[model samples]
Target: MELYGLVTLVGVFLLLALEPVLARNPLHHPRLDRWCNNIGLAFTNELIRFFLPLALALVAVDGPWQAFNASSLGLLWGALLAFIIMDFSLYWVHRCSHELRWLWRLHRTHHSDLDMDVTTSFRHHPGEVGLKLVLMSGFIGLLGFTPAHLLTYVLLHRCFALWSHSNIRLPEGLERQLAKVLVTPRVHQIHHSAWQPETDSNYGQILTLWDRLFKTYLSPDQVPCPARFGLEDFRSAEDQRLSALFAQPIR
Candidate 1:
């Protein structure tokens, strides 16, 4: 858990510094309120995370269904399976966040960002965070997942989340190959497209397998990279305020 938090923060800071040099579409040299607001939101979430019990802190369940047994495999294999299962869970959770209107309200705070950058990855609503926590915890418990499995998965997930949301462009050929298995930045940029149909697709977090299987994927070649992001109506200056973000879901 400590490692998870450390990796997330470090990845964000590293990306923050590196983004300008590597940015596909260079944003303002010194970002204004938006960047700070996103960071502020992330800090609040870190506090929320601190108070909430860690993912592995759950009491073991004795249900008939067991998703994976960590003891059955070596640690490396267990972590690999754990991430695959967790990514699958994320694919559904993320898809639901867009497909369901009420849930979309909680999710829009993230998409509401007019810009797509590393910080945008941390712009989730508190309610959305809590919702993910509950749903993901249930999945973990059902599987009887181990601490080691979860710890490894969280670090990996967060690192990829930051990478996927980054504005830095990867080589098209390399990204094309990666998108075959993993969700690349190009793939995720399509997911953030302001167009509703495009926004609703590419819900995979780590792996492209689920999106491809479920047919929710919009090919990067089709939509094009560096697509316009965020909801059209939600782009007003007032709408970007930190206070407005908290009230957004209910409003």
Candidate 2:
């Protein structure tokens, strides 16, 4: 699991470096400081996770209903089922983070970024990470998923999270087709729009199916205008600081 995590981290770092250089309309504003702050926040979340590494394992169920057990549904089918279940769980958790005031307070730290880049995917507040860990552990335990299933989902989840937040522009046709099945960058950028309604939509982390199923999906054409990313309340430079980001959930 640790090895896979390291590989995903490096892959995301490479994407973060390459995407903007390939972007057609990359932000002209200076991003170094914001990138540093976002990375700092990510590092803090990792530190928290390191100490709480067993949260998922501890909550895992070992009963007869273990769906992912090799003797039951078989490893392949079990993994696939577990992945879909977890993805669905993530959609609701993400949606609640916006609808519920307390969760939104922690979530706003990620939305506070003025620019959307690969690094922006890692801008989650530590509080949000803790909340997600608790929620995800419960979900995993309830569903009887194994360590391998969780690891597979984590890799795919991390990849999509970074890809959806990338600054790179995809070929129009390709992006359109991809958005039908996956959550593409164009689709996700709308979610980060400073406008409240847009910000509240596109809550899916991996599959776009959940949003479509829940009627929360918003296509680019559906938007009234092109989105200006970031939270209106956190537009000031001072609010983008690492210290301010950590304090945002309470303030």
Candidate 3:
């Protein structure tokens, strides 16, 4: 857990600092107030996810509710299975958040940001945070995952997520190669597209496998460069205020 915290801290620090310098285009959100509110909200949501674990099965999995135990498959194989499950589960949850109306309301808080950058990665609503945490924690019990397995997954998934959401411009060839397996920033930028169809595509989390397998993959080349981000309804600058964003789901 300590390592997980350290990795997360480092990931956030490096990307938040680098994105502005390496940004492909000029910085969009110049308002300092919006930055403070967005970052503050993100911090609160991250705390909930890091601190709450009653729902996560970090101990023995002898309970009768166990559906399938991967421990029988050996440590390496079980760990592999756990990693795949974690990635794909995140894919479905993200996909469903778009398809399902209520989920979209919560998820839209993330997309509602008119300006997309590394900090946008941290702009998820508390509702979405709690929802994903509750859902993702189920894998530990069902798959017989230990604390170490989950902590490792947490570090990888979260760091990759921050990276994918970042605005740093990667070289075209390198970005293309990485996007073949992992969800690179270019690929994820399409998912953040303001266009409805594009927004519904590229639903992968850590890996692009799920999106390709499920036929939701959309190539970055298919969309305009720096695809327009944010939702149509929340386009105004004032809508991005901390209070408006916090109350958005109900509105």
Considering every candidate listed, which one attains the maximal lDDT? 2
As a TM-score, model 2 comes out at 0.91
Q: What lDDT tens digits, residue by residue, belong to model 1 across residues 145-223?
A: 7667677777777888999999888888998889999888888888887888888899998889998899998888777
Give candidate 2 misplaced runs (Cα > 4 Å): 50-54, 63-71
Write candidate 2's Cα lDDT for 1-251 as tens digits: 58656866887878867885777345744789978998899888877665553565554657554444432566777788878988998999999999999988999999988888888888999989987887677667666766666667777888898888888788889988999988988889989888888888999988899999999999865665345778888888888888999999888
Lowest lDDT 10-mer window, candidate 1? 53-62
Q: RMSDs, each prediction?
A: 2.4, 2.4, 1.9
For candidate 2, what is the lDDT? 0.81
Give the lDDT ranking, best first. Answer: 2, 1, 3
For each candidate in the order shown, give its overall lDDT on alpha carbons.
Answer: 0.80, 0.81, 0.80
Separate clash counts for every candidate: 0, 0, 0
Q: Model 3, poorest ten-residue lDDT window? A: 53-62
| Residues 1-251 of candidate 3: C-alpha lDDT, one tens digit per residue | 57767887798789878986888655566648657767878878978877765446754365676787666777677777778888888888898999999999999999987766777778888988987776666656766776555655677888888898888899989988998999998899888888888889999878899999999999876677655678889877788789889999999
Best-performing candidate as measured by TM-score: 3
